[model samples]
Target: MRPVVFPHWFHRIRFRCKVCHAELGFKMRAGANQIKMTDIIDGRFCGACHDGETAWSVENCDLCHSGKAGLPPGIFGGHETLGPGRW
Candidate 1:
């Protein structure tokens, strides 16, 4: 699987640790959870928050799959610049 770009700072702005750790059952350590895409599409793990009504829909693959090309601006507070230098 490709690397997932989970912007913690973004989630932190809205949620606390318990929200994901205690409530959602996400392991504190990364890669501890053997998350399967089917689980998500079937409404589990990330699906708990990304079921469209909650956050961005899972069907929107790029939302989770990153580095393919183009990420939304303001994702990193818009600090990251794109392309060549200014003229």
Candidate 2:
């Protein structure tokens, strides 16, 4: 299956770490969550906010899943880094 690109900047801009990690209960480490389409569809994991009404819907797969492993350097798209930038 394709991997999900968790947009840290996007999330952090609108929410706090505790919102997803504590209130929504997302795992900190990668590969820790047994994420499945069904789980997301059932309002679990990413589905908590991506339920269309809350945030974007999960069916809009292309927004998150690029199907490509880590993007190459120089492709940062105006950002200084892959995530946190120059901080």
Candidate 3:
């Protein structure tokens, strides 16, 4: 199975776990999301949010699946570095 690096922070804002997990019936573990190109083309998984609302579309593969170990550095823009006090 291919790796699926979902944009965690992006979805957290507008959706709850149930939306993708229970509602969409996705697995909790990594590589268990059961995503497929066919599904996306049919408006599922990445295609669901990547339809140009929350972020870039599935056509922009690098936006989510960069084929890297993790999210590229600075992608979150110091948001992870900040703490409750910083806000």
Candidate 4:
């Protein structure tokens, strides 16, 4: 199964940064949070809103987990670094 390709830019257009970063308590740093399907199913993280009402339900596997397979993990489309100026 392909990993979920989280359309950050797409979500950014609909909601503000605080929606996920602040209110949801998501870390600003990429790959900072170790997300799990169980947590989301329990109404945490993405589940906070994606419970079929605010957003799509997690049952829709293909919806989110659509990333290409065999890709190196750790924030796709961006460079994985230690921190500011640590790259």
lDDT of each: 0.67, 0.66, 0.58, 0.75
TM-score of each: 0.69, 0.69, 0.57, 0.77
Instruction: Compose the digit string of candidate 2's lDDT tens values, residues 31-87.
Output: 466677898899987888889998889778877775476642111132234455544
| lDDT tens digits by residue: candidate 1, 1-87 | 345666655676577768988988888764467777898888887889899997888778876777444543222321143212422
Candidate 1's TM-score reads: 0.69
State, as a TM-score between 0 and 1, how close model 3 is to the true structure: 0.57
Q: Candidate 2 deviates by what RMSD?
A: 5.2
Model 3 is weakest, by summed lDDT over 10 consecutive residues, at: 71-80
Q: In angstroms, how far off is 27's CA in candidate 3?
A: 1.7
lDDT of 1: 0.67
Model 4, residue pairs in steric clash: 3-67, 4-64, 4-65
lDDT of 3 by residue, 1-82 (tens): 2235554556656677689777767666545555667887677876676677765776776665554555332233222434
Clashes of 3: 0
- TM-score: which is higher, 2 or 4? 4
TM-score computed on alpha carbons, candidate 4: 0.77
